[model samples]
Target: MKDWWIYKGDPAVPTDRRLARLAEHRPPWRVFEGKVDPDHKVPSLDDKQYAADRERGAGYLADDAEIDLVNTALLLRRPLLVTGVPGVGKSTLAYSIAEDLGLGPVLRWPITSRATLRDGLYRYDALRRLEDANLTRMQATSDEQLLDAPEAEEGDARPADAVTPPADGIGRYLRLGPLGTAFLPTDRPRVLLVDEIDKCDIDLPGDLLTVLDEGRFDIPELTRLADHRRTVTVGTEDPDVRARITAGRVQCRAFPVVVLTSNGEREFPPAFLRRCIRLTIERPGEDKLRRIIEQRIGAGAAAAAAAPDGLISRFLERRERGELGTDQLLNAVQLRLAGAWTAPDEIGQLAQATLQPLSGPDAT
Candidate 1:
């Protein structure tokens, strides 16, 4: 993506050399103080804890090919662009990677129509500025009175102990947006989920090229003040600006795991595409579907026993006839189990009613 060697330098190196470089950046896997074995850096489903995470969320069947792609993205420190239909778990890759590396869950930025660069970096606060100005005025007023009244004795403490110059206004308070937070100086890399990028305007994706390539962004508003002043009034998560300045600009300590998802609705600019490794998610196979259903429904044996003879046959018949998808099959099975529908007639009726109409031409 964007010539990985451009900002970060040449990527032409042996596997071991690349891994060594990644280590120097303090990648997420290195910062984890958890049960993840360092010798086996890539945590797989074979690991119990990793399996638990999979169970908690829909797991990515990270086949060997997928692993290679993941490793390449990490080594290059470029964005991984996942494209697939809805419900195929493209966005979940970020979460899984974060969990595998013990970097915690991802910080998600759900793209929308109004999203902009500033929206993803920081938000200005007017209330804090007003309070700061008010405080400054009050202090100035008191100093004026003390100066006008009389002169103090020599060596006496100055009347105005130097007004601490009101705290920087809310405009200086910059809390990291999801993207900003992901770049924050962490002991380990953070995962950033740019979900449904297709929903955003065309220009938004292009705008991200700079920061993504540079591995940093300057919060001019915050940086300008932070560089020159010790304390500035900035917005806080608090309701009142007068309350406190709790947020500040944070710089990146390491590259982050950036995953951007798309629903294949719109194409991105060539420049944007050039900076990402694209992965297309395929629909789950029959066996995978069965496993998913068994995991979700708790009727594994029952569903399997009945599948070959009639249940699966009927399910496929409907699916072949464009009557249902995998989700509906699972839904019907769960309903059958919950209702104790053991007889073929009962099960068929329930499955047909639940799935058949939904896929029909007139359904929508």
Candidate 2:
């Protein structure tokens, strides 16, 4: 397992090499069998979505230490708890993994102050179901009344069950969130990105401990009717792809490669931390910043190379002062090269606008 881990700062490990290592040291299958969607097959990374992932990943520049942590998380099948400052590529890690391993679209669950564990798992539209049920009842009643009205028109006298909606159609109101959908059984595991988890309520992480540990969850609404109905088809995170829930339970055939990102805003419980494989991303140093800037702006003219190097020096100085973000540095560098600031003095003056240290209450 340790042999599979690489400490290279690059995310561009060859796919064949990765697969060979995986084949040699496969983990125990915790995968669940999910209802297959023949129509919505997982596409290759050649699409626009994967293209964006590739671009962002190349720009993010994960160090060898970060790469090793990623491999460890993949081999263990445990949720990775990534802590870093904003714009440090914590959420981006998920996309990098997806693009590198050809793991299909990453199911991203963005957290907020109001987010809850159930919000990430699945959502049941009780109000919508109630409305649907009422509509069905009215349709049934109207049909019955027409039947007893002594045949107003020949075609109007249709079967009572014709317009009556199926009671089992309640399944339409249930939709699985990214977290729940990740648990569906599949030959390959999905990448579940829990973005900005630090924004979640204190209890949210604690609430997830069980679901993460057990690799399954039950929908009580479906569970109640399990005895009456053999299988209920419910909507999944993927469009047009639905899964059947037997006994109202969703269990993963293969544990999802879950990546939960935090910005060091809050502390999680020790229990929650213990369940995860943790990694903290450090700020980009000079070499990494240079590579990142080069990736974003690209290599071309000697002027371009010099422009980024000069900006990198100033960016590092500002960073030491704890004011500007790495993204701001990229923006400054790009602006410096794009404009008609032929004079170095003019470029420096414009760069100050973006490179200036953040001030005021929001600085933190």
Using lDDT, give the best candidate's number: 2
lDDT of each: 0.61, 0.74
- Encode model 1's per-residue lDDT on 193-260: one tens digit a residue: 89999999768998999878766666566555564553344332212322111123344555788999
Stretches of candidate 1 above 4 Å error? 1-58, 131-172, 230-250, 295-306, 309-333, 340-343, 346-364
Local error of candidate 2 at 239, Å? 2.8
Candidate 2 per-residue C-alpha lDDT over 1-364 given as tens digits, one digit per residue, 9 for 90 to 100: 2445632323466665665555455465533445544443544557774677666654556777888888777777679999987767788888877766767778889999999888888899999878867887888787778767874665775664554555657688899899998887665678899999988998999999888877889989889997888578888887677777778888876578899999887889999998899999988877777677766776652235345547677667666666466788777767756774546666566556676665432221
> How many residue pairs clash in each candidate at the backbone level?
8, 12
RMSD each, Å: 9.6, 3.8
